[model samples]
Target: MKFVNSLLGLSLLLAASSQAHALSRNAGQTNQSAQQESPDSPRPILLNYTLLKTIDLATLSQNLASFGIKARNGVSIYKVSYATESLDDTSLNASGIIIIPDTKAAVFPWVSIQHGTIIAKAEAPSVAPFEGLAEASQGFVAVAADYIGYGDSAALPHPYIIAKGYQKPLVDLLRAARELANQKDFDLGPLFLKGYSEGGYATLALQKALETDYSTEFSIVASAPSAGPYNVELTGVLNVEKPVVNPVNLPFVVLAYNYWLADGQLALNDIFLPAVATVEDALSGAYNSDQVFAILPSTASGLFQSAFVADFTSDQPTLPTSRDLRALLRTQTLLDGWIPKAPTRFYHCIDDNEIPVAVTEQAVATFKAAGAPSISSVLIPSPTTGQPYLHGNCPAIFSPLQWFGEILSGKAAQ
Candidate 1:
């Protein structure tokens, strides 16, 4: 996890260019003045390329303000529309909000963002605490996909982990950002991907797909995936007894099973029992986070002998039981499949009760073994004293200042 001093080279380039352009322009002006024989006759001196290219910071700030973001101390914050190609047969007419810096028009860089589960558009404004947008405004073009059914679109059963469906939204969003950059006033630069919680899983999926499918169009500068369950089955086992576990995660397993099973990979009947089926039906309509958590266990318990114990048994033939499931899920599928084509920064709080820190730590190990360009894992302090009470403080844990400085300075590993 070493960050190279590449920003030094960039700084030198900017300084040298400015000095050379200034000297060249001054010399040309002096020659033009001398050529004017008459005091009344004046010749126009040609300006240097650097002067022509110079950006008026004040003007830029004014333009950025129109987009509901403020620029201060050389950083511009703004939200703009970014078009994305739809994967579900609908041609065109799809877009999302991309928060980026006004200065990125000069040095374009890419940053892909993924949101967590059950949270949609209105929820997003609260989720990351505006850090994602700030990241973009600081110097990166940060793109966040509303995941097909969240933002301005229909809220049908969100296909949680159906790989093709999930990845398409993200990839299309990235494509949209690139397309926007090609416009007269945009600068699309090198790309990076970041996500938290369920988004971590989506980010990994996009990274894998990009390396395998879209390498030519996009290059991954770095990726930060935090607190995602790479292994679906393992997640189920880990949450069996945890009171915080809810139906929000249930859809993911169902979706995964539906996807794989539809591909003839596994039979649903063989993997799940009648009780699990009833539980799934009851939990499907649960909307907000509170309802999902409050009703899931009771509904599931009514269907099965015990909501936690009955669903996972040692005798299950095809699908692994709770014990074996934990081992299987603990394995990092996302890290196992994708070769890190760029640097990666993985962060997870040691006190994360929802997604176990052990899972994230394992992922870090997996990426390291794969010879990832840069894999940095940060362990933030626990907010609680005991019993692991603190929740929903990821933004504070992974400070925006540190994240932005690392990426903007090109000190990010991978």
Candidate 2:
């Protein structure tokens, strides 16, 4: 027993020493590169996964100062990556925040966060609105994926409707977290999934894919998805008259179809005017959400007059006949016959002006009808008196945390 114990200790010591050496080498190389660059045109400070873990709040604040990522009291950030197999072409590159407890024992449960639509690095923080739940209440590690076209890789187009494009990043990110946990110093127990709006849809689709595709590698403890368009076709139909949903989401959906369908059958000329032709180039290369939204109104107006509308409307007969056919073609859908294999807690506000709450209700009913295990949906009542929360706010989305806590504590309905 003593010999075996000594051997294990030696192995741990070797691992720790190797990790420290690698960190030192990387830091030295970075410093050397910085020195070679001109003082006026210095290279951006890049934080790696391992170096980020070694930093405390104070050190993190100092490091982020250079990058303009303000490190507030409760906001904790870290960098990470994962190898994924779900992408159609190139490997997915994912990077984002990680909030976990200071102590080892406290780190067990994990939550993977997905952000909303067209949001890029500038608005990336929005992806972690309820970060407190992961860092404080749940004692879990919360990881947010920046998706393929955001933050680190800003040149690629955001794949809005292409499920595989998003799925690769999500799956790879979760795998990265698990890989991090397996390290000698890291410890992550079970994991739960959560997201809002487009993120919500991502969470559900990821959960479904994990169960059916990557079940051997990942086990989801629970999931909470809010205001996601689980059924893409239905969402496009409902949003045409609403305008808020269709126009805002059209570019992303069209981009996804263009990338995923592989035929290059979808064209900007079909939907947008010559003036808006450059819009796709701008959007595809955007590094922030503000840029995406800035181009929406003009882009939408141009699409209204295109032949693409007629073809799209003709393709999706279920969409309201009165709505423009082009908008319907750009709508979201679930690619027939996809379902989740885990218990999921669905939440939505009854008065949500953005994505309709009815969409959430429909998803819940669909999951239940399909005999999903331990599925529950909660409709948060409109603000009563003192409290008022808008769409995608934290407090309004508390039920998901509660459900996740229940699952972590082994109390979730099976």
Candidate 3:
């Protein structure tokens, strides 16, 4: 525990700062008991699981290509509710989808998918219930957490980049998923985690947390976090000053971070110019992903004040507020200086225009240097020419392919 704390000192600092700021912002909005149940709260436990829907292999295969169904498999989607602490350490109810195989197979490892950023609550794994079915068709008990602010917990603000905030619900849902599988006579095995984009960040974040804090309670045989803004400082923070092909990323990151760290009280004026700052509500979950992007300007520089962009681009931020924002973004990073206890594989495309390939390449190098036992990185090549594609184009589409390929190769479960 001490070692985990030592490695995550900066992350813990961010959580602490969030709590302190939250107390000041939300004192009247929440109860004292709600804020008290946090890091010191009881260890997470499975509350219950409610079956939502079921799907067969024929139906699953119709949607996904390159997924081979070897057995007469069926999937049961369950709305898994569990107890977990909120970003500010308050006790809150959360939910996820537990997609378990209905096959009579003896046992198999768990494959959990952390989905990308979503606005509408229904798009979450629990409501959509079809997100991880392709993986479940392979006889793995697939689980996908709705994170904090989706599904049953939609009223609370989503802690977009908070790693620990999502990790707790994932851990608890796995327990509930396994229990539900047991009730249905499906055996279980080792665990594997995979996700792309924001989900990728979460997959890696949970892997690190499970390896350290929950080492005794859970384990992932392998993990693949592809093209996430894992290097939050560079990809998420500093790069906001540069001209970005996608303008929405900067405001989305800033808005979400302020919502969590500042108790939804942080002024948009501090981070954005009048154009972007004035439309803060639209940036929230009220609008869909595409709608939010359309609302913001097309260029990153257009989103912020000209002087702030000048300061950021010159690598000399004079504004005191930008430094604090930068620090908050830094806390969102994963796998840079941490050591892993399990064999891990990183997947990224060389031409990934969203998150830089350099981030993934450099992290793999640093993890090896930090003495991770077994670590490897794979490139998800283009579908036709077998070369890397742009960040969002290729890697976003290849997450499940990489996950299923690993399963076929017996990388995580043998």
**Highest TM-score model number:** 3
Measured by C-alpha RMSD in angstroms, how accurate is candidate 3?
Answer: 11.1
lDDT of 1 by residue, 175-284 (tens): 65554455426767667777777787888888888888888878876777777776655555555445444555644455444443333243334333344564455445
- TM-score to native of every candidate shown: 0.65, 0.71, 0.81
Clashing pairs in 2: 232-332, 232-333, 309-326, 313-325
Tens digit of lDDT per residue, candidate 2, span 200-276? 88888788778878899888877888877777766654554453443447555655565655345554454554344
Model 2 ranges off by over 4 Å: 1-76, 121-137, 243-247, 285-294, 298-303, 306-332, 335-339, 384-398, 410-414
TM-score of model number 2: 0.71
Q: Which one wins on lDDT? A: 3
Q: By TM-score, is 1 or 3 better? A: 3
Off by over 4 Å in 1: 1-94, 102-104, 119-131, 152-155, 241-244, 259-286, 298-332, 384-391, 396-401, 410-414
Worst ten in a row by lDDT for model 3:
28-37
The CA lDDT of each predicted structure is: 0.52, 0.57, 0.68
How far does residue 142 in candidate 2 sit from its true spot (Å)?
1.3
